[model samples]
Target: MKRRATALATLLLTGAGLGMLTVPAEAAPAAPTRTTAVCPTGWGSTQKTGTSAATASLVNIRTGRHDCFDRMVFHVPGVGSSKIGYRVGYVSRLYQDGSGNHIPVAGGAVLEVRVAAPGYDPDTGKATYAGKVNKPLPGVNLTGYRTFKDTRFAGSFEGDTQIGIGVRARLPFRVLQLPDRLVVDVAHTWGTAR
Candidate 1:
């Protein structure tokens, strides 16, 4: 009986040792990684213009942000006692190096904005300005404003300033979208420069 008991204890010890050998040591977790793009604030204003035509000029306006943002908004305050039309066209251009190498940047979706006053029209029945052909308008033109948002501009920014095009047009205008550019034209009005 004692021999049997000793043999059982030896077996138990050997089994315990084998179990210990099969266990794996815990590994320390890897250090956390930092991943983000930092943009700047107050980059001032940058403006560009396209070739002039009979209707209106195409302009590009960009504002600098201290930090990178996913979207951009344009604010057009109402022009009191002014009878004119207001519109905006937006586009994004990729960055280019001085050496002629182009960096592949994501382009923002096209956005077009139009403004008109409610309950006011110089010509109520017709599109032609026959009665007031030489006048601005009969009443105060209640101007309107709007904002559009765009994403996918990440990692393509050189600084806090965003890359985009702004076109403020008069009336009876059209925006032509191309594969890599946009064109806007206006008639019978004037657009204020910002």
Candidate 2:
């Protein structure tokens, strides 16, 4: 009986040792590295080349929301591949489009967008864009945006048209020139500047 008891104890110890040496069926993968989108670079105050004789007429103005930034597009029609010159920067105050009167916009900072193209048809001497030339242009709506607060038409004069954009703060912005449009995108945060 003592021999039998000793044999059983030896068997139990060997089983326990084997169990510790067994490999797991699978090991959990190392936690995936967190990834983030790479923001665009060089989007601060910028200017592009355009022509003074270009006859691009402003047709529309609109805004869109993005994951990283807010966008504003100024559409000009009937101008081929001509580049529209523009200046985008923060301003102390927003002035009326044509009258140069102080216009109040709701935001922490105001961006002045000036396009080289006019908002009128030179042939007919009539306004090409039918929106309000004053504060609160008819179609631009900024209801649930994070950066944009308000938009106002600053007016068109001497072959240049201006629009006032109210943002949460003075953030990094980029300008893009398409065949028929000019695009402005403002970063939601200064840290996320591309």
Best by TM-score: 2
Flag clash pairs in model 1.
39-66, 40-65, 40-66, 41-65, 41-66
Quote model 2's TM-score.
0.75
- Tens-digit per-residue lDDT, 1-194, candidate 2: 99999999999999999988887768646778767666765566544344543567898888999877899998888665677778778888977655768878779998888888778986787998866665676687889888999988877888788888989988888887777888899888766432
lDDT of each: 0.29, 0.80
Q: Write the per-residue lDDT of candidate 1 for residues 17-124, one digit (tens) a residue.
A: 998777455654567977654433332222222331212111222222222222222212232223223334333433322233323322223323322221122334
User: Where does the lowest 10-residue lDDT sum fall in candidate 2?
Assistant: 45-54
Q: Number of the top candidate by lDDT?
A: 2
Clashing residue pairs for model 2: 40-194, 41-194, 97-154, 97-155
Badly placed stretches (over 4 Å) of model 2 are 1-35, 46-53
Error of 1 at 38 (Å): 6.3
* lDDT against true structure, model 1: 0.29
Error of 2 at 95 (Å): 2.0
Clash totals for all models, in order? 5, 4
Task: For residue 142, give model 2's deviation from the true position in Å.
Answer: 1.6
